[model samples]
Target: MRTNTGRLSTRRLWALSAAVLAGVGGAFASVTTGETKATTRADHFLQARAAPTTAMPPTATASVTTESPATTAGRPVVSPVLPFNAKLTSSDIPVRGGGVRSGACSGSLIAPEWIITAGHCFHDINGAWVGGKPRYHMTVTVGKLKDGDPGGHTAQVVDVRQSPVNDLAVAKLSTAIDDVVPLTLPDKAPEVGQRLRFAGWGSTSATVVAPSDHLKRGEFSVAKIAPTTLEALPVVPRTVENSPCADDSGSPYFVSGDNRTGNLVAIENSGPPCPQPGREIIARVDILTDWIRTQTGDTAR
Candidate 1:
């Protein structure tokens, strides 16, 4: 598995190497390679800095990389958490083949139509994988905090399913969604240092590309937890920046301690250029919780 293409400056972040790691935002975004054709536009981007690769082992690959759209470098939560605040937000289904929706990528809400994100944000733009059973649609906004904020609650995916190993996926919305509430997965996982808790809407700037509708959060710890994948690292030190950026790719890494606490484990995948600091990776939802309960059969509480 080897495919590499680069552009991502004006907002064309696309980089998939070995097995996983698509850029743009939720799978990142932005695409317009050769033929001199360029019209990709989607604000919430992410992607840059993948880290794992021993020649690609771990079943085959599944290193989890794809980031480059939306927004997420942290900073905004003045008082978030209100209506169904399990945190959710995603966008990238503009379809045209390659992708380019710019911003939106941050989810959590285990079962209620399943949420989970980051299968390269459902591919597109040449990377393929657009979300089974679909006519090109990916929207998951719920109780939003900014970006138009009217009470939140959008949903319209249908199906996605991706995680034979890691960068994980779940989609399947278009129905449930009323009061949020779903996050609670971690039966075992997350240790290295513990102290997680990261939400997202993305874009706080680690280089520029801005895209934050609000719904932000910070706090990092778990330095490394391999098994499927995990990174964290950022208790606030790297010159005061925090971590997780570039549309925060499928964001949702929580487990505040106190005995399970918020639970959830990890989701976002790809980091390092955000707000300056580093280490973010994230993907191990407690070993995928029985592969997300056989793909959203929901039971692994």
Candidate 2:
């Protein structure tokens, strides 16, 4: 499935422009001089985009590109803080190898020790397989506002449960977090054209990484497309197109207007790659309440 990187903030747009110009010029020369080597580099780039760097155990063998520390310092946090809400941080859930190495989806805290994310984000990395047992190897960080580094608390996944068809996963944290308040889930499906806010530690601009692991949040009108429209998209499992990209996987998609009464509608899933514009697909949280309650032992209305 295509991963959806959120739109860039104005400040980030300027920084990305400068970086792209400088890097693209150098990359062009390298591509021309060594086409074979360029292919390998391209492959690595695509692989990073497809799988989370930290999806596997430390012993697992996989090739990953490491960015320079200098570049890391310049990256900005993408989402702005709302009056009563805290943006979800990337550090809350650092992918094993750091950044986009983990599949690029976002997640949200539903209970003290339970987080909700997309099932597809925990799918097979090879993309050759269809359905099977769900994997919980991806690391989840909560309450962080920055990327790579979790501000304070961190937790490893104890278990993961996925819904049969929808892209939903409920994960148990190693320990309960006391500081970060868990968000609530609604019993009803979201309305068409309802304004919603999606928060994550994902890429700021389409293709480029935002500097900090800080939580980034954005507003999107829930363009309720027909389920048939989603079925027509070229997605895996022949399903929807409401997922997040880059660092957004496993992030929360929440309603914004009512603040205290807002409901979490979906978990970040997948979307089109950077430079390609598309809608994000999220695993509908309300649809799978029974499954979630059974797995996480949380009451779902």
Candidate 3:
């Protein structure tokens, strides 16, 4: 599969996107050829739009493209500040043989010690999926209202595993996060036209290129569903401003429930520039429920 990269005014969102898309707000965070974090909390469901009628083939590439170091695109954190947000990034995500990569990313806690994110977040210099250790120093921060907020749990990422079928990946944290409840994985697939919610860390819009520390949560409707991916359009505001931006990779898309908890179904991958443009191409997680269970110790119902 071949992936193409896009450029922005200031920051480049995501990494190596074949132009498809979901997650917390990522797998969208564009690494400045550089780096990329954020979360998803669904508290409300707003109005939605009809699904796109066009038939789209599955793209092998998952997110936008990772370009540099601290300038990655895509936003992750999206909220007033709560748990469940797994902000992802590495000082240098090592590629096998040689070279290193760094960037911002977002994810959702699936278990006491596990977080799920975009597989492309751990790719090699050549864009091939990488496994085993991630981040020369991988750190996951939860519940940070602002970028520099210290009021959250930070854990060490020990192991990284990529899916063979889709753009999903799981990380094993050194310590278990006992405070926040992990997002749920539903067995049912998301229907087209369904309105789902998301919260990711990102710049407010394409024009607002600087990464924000605050979580940006909003609602969107599913446009189309594929075997392993889906497309969504911004629905809450139903404008380009409400759409997911370029940086956050692995931000979650979920069905919101009571008390901020939600169902994990898909993650942010890639698409056009934020605040406007094409539908988002996201990786579907529902298809891999069983495998994620096995990898993360079967999250209790």
Candidate 4:
């Protein structure tokens, strides 16, 4: 779908393309409620889009860099281009083809076995999402920089949890990830206009073109919209620009300001093309501290 700015909305574009998986007899189903319920075959399908009437605060800060023209092009493209040989490890997520699969999104290590990622990344074919339970098939891989293939270390996802209403998700690995040090979450919210860094193995460029299989990274500055403006637009927190594209949906948005600390503030939710003019809203993890603690049974604060 095209946005007011004339660019294709990545989130909507991916959702529509993903529907093809269902057409091939995949068990994909749209989720309506937050609670788990019985699954049934869908008679029709509605592409996921930005829900209207949701409110957001204006001028919030992000921990990444701003977008550039070159980075916004269609196709799988990496930005602030990293060295071709730069070594980085990524978690591996396998999904069933045809319909949306139950595989959760790949994430980066934040602690010994803790990985950070977007909450929406975890899902099943029917979209009846599940988390905070050991039953979820969450997994983490390290020492590999390529997508799909786990280069070095791999571990089973032991537990998955998220903050209520926040886009952040943390997964505990069954075993410790050696060699790679864990990234840290920000203790405080980012200031307005803070530059941030984002990395993932999802589609490198927009979804209009073919998705990329190689790991891609980009930089995006946080753009905050007035809560009134957000409410007026009736924008859902999940659907906003400067967010993740199709496959990058579950990647984490990390801090890249003067503070060298790699604190996480947002997870890719939805958005238009890279660096598009619009408020890229993320589920504010800082605001949902208590809920996160309750779900994980950990004293995060």
Best candidate (score: TM-score): 3
lDDT of 4 by residue, 1-301 (tens): 1111123222221111223323523222222322212111111011222222233222231111122212123422222222111111222222233321122243566665566665555544453334655433444544445544423455666677743333356666666643444455556655566665665544334434222355555556655532110100112232223234444544556664432235665555444344343434443445444444455454655
Estimate, for each residue in 1-301, the C-alpha lDDT of model 1 and write its tens digit.
Answer: 0001222545232222323322223332222223222112122332322322223223221121222223234321212352333333333333233433333456766767777877666665444545575434445665556755544555567788776555667778766753445677777766889887777666565445444656677788887665566766778764212345655577777764442226678877665444555566667877668767877785544
For model 2, residues 1-301, the per-residue Cα lDDT tens digits are 1222333221110001223324442111111211111011112112443345443344332212122322224542221232212222222123335544423345667777777765544434353212233332445555445555313344555666655444456666666755555677677766666666666655555445432245555666565432211111222221112323355555666775544334677655444453244455444667566666777676544
lDDT of each: 0.54, 0.44, 0.59, 0.40
Model 3 agreement with the true structure over 80-179: per-residue lDDT tens digits: 3347877765444433454433355678888888988777666555555567875346567765656665346667778887765666789898777666
Candidate no. 3 TM-score: 0.68
Better TM-score candidate (1, 2)? 2
If the candidates were sorted by their lDDT against the true structure, best first, what order would they fall in?
Answer: 3, 1, 2, 4
**Lowest lDDT block of 10, candidate 1:** 35-44
TM-score per candidate:
0.29, 0.57, 0.68, 0.53
Supply candidate 3's per-residue lDDT for 57.
21
> What is the C-alpha RMSD, rounded to one decimal, of candidate 1?
18.5
Q: Give the C-alpha miss distance for residue 125 in model 1, angstroms.
A: 6.1
Error of 3 at 102 (Å): 3.8
Best of the candidates, lDDT: 3
